[model samples]
Target: MSVVETLLVFAVIPLAIVLLFAVLTLLPGRAKKARYKPGQPWQYQPVWWEPHPLHGPAAGNHDDGPKAIGSSVYQEPQAIGSGHGSASHGATSHGSTSHGATAHGATSHGATAVGASAAQPAPVSAGPLGGARGTW
Candidate 1:
């Protein structure tokens, strides 16, 4: 083979591989801590991002009552990167809202009743101690 062709095959090919290895090794690996869990309820983290209040205002699609959506009846404290959670956070009793059963509960801001219209899965509450509570 011609010297040019031989050098192109051996030298250029090895150089390409070395470059590839260096590039791959230096790439920023996944952050040791990422905030994403698909197929599960929206996991909340109290991470102080640029824009707080993480979500937009609750829409008008109130399922049980006009006060169900944005009402302060139930709101759970976000347990984000703090790595802190506890079971003592307690739960809201649906018996206060209706005679029926529900899947989850909350504090000042939460879903208390699963009205006949919202017969779907109720919101699941991750207890303050990093665990799912109730049927949800």
Candidate 2:
């Protein structure tokens, strides 16, 4: 065989293969889908790092504007009612006003339920498998 042909067959092919492999590694590959795969059944695996579904904002629906609370539903902010001083100011005896506004019975905000602890699996112990020791 000619030296040029031997060089092309032996060196050029391997160099071309290596270059192609490097180019493929440099290019971004397809993103791995977390939800659905080709043949496997659809499964819902909850990731521990993500927010718990309970405390997140209401799903799908995003109309977060304030809604009607009591009667006189569409009144302007000034027309709604006056704010009586809160019970912390020792003013709990304010007469009931329009919309039954009162500082009394106000719920303390910022309270949350303690989350459950995720228990770890027990450790496996080594034991004799072949009919126990000295029984044979």
Candidate 3:
């Protein structure tokens, strides 16, 4: 075949076909949707949905509506160890004392206690501490 015909069949036609598809793909995106810009008031209505409405705290019984999402509710922290023979901070083998204190509630210094009651777990506090923050 001639050079012009060979180049048309091997390169020019393939390049034209690729360019045609690229233009076609980009044409649809040109008709853009309305977008939010900085300093402009929002034009869309907000929507909220809860899956289990009947079982929630509001439950249609309260004068006010259901609580908003991400609202904080403060709950009193309960004591970890409550029952007898349970391990609390520095309880002895009989499980009736605390912090190296004797069974008669007398405090003792430098007393070595063994088992799970000896090691004190770190206290957990609610709310966020200053650290890394993120958003979705």
Tell me the whole-model lDDT of each prediction, alpha carbons only: 0.38, 0.33, 0.40
Q: Model 2 RMSD to the real structure?
A: 21.9
Q: Which rank order by TM-score, best down to worst? A: 3, 2, 1
Backbone collisions counted per model: 12, 0, 0
- Give the better candidate number (1 or 2) by lDDT: 1
lDDT for model 2: 0.33
Candidate 2 lDDT, 1-136, residue by residue in tens: 9999999999999999999998898766645766555687755421112223332222432233111222211211121233211211122123212123222212122221111111212235558555546621
TM-score of each: 0.22, 0.24, 0.25
Q: TM-score of predicted model 3?
A: 0.25
Q: Give Cα distance to truth, residue 1, candidate 3, Å.
A: 0.6
Model 1 Cα lDDT, one tens digit per residue, 1-136: 9999999999999999999998898777646776565566666533211222224224322233222322223332343232211111222232323323321322232232223232223446777766567752
Model 2: residues with Cα > 4 Å off, grouped in runs:
29-136
| Colliding residue pairs in candidate 3 | none
The lowest-lDDT stretch of 10 consecutive residues in candidate 2 is: 112-121
Q: Which scores better on TM-score, 1 or 2?
A: 2
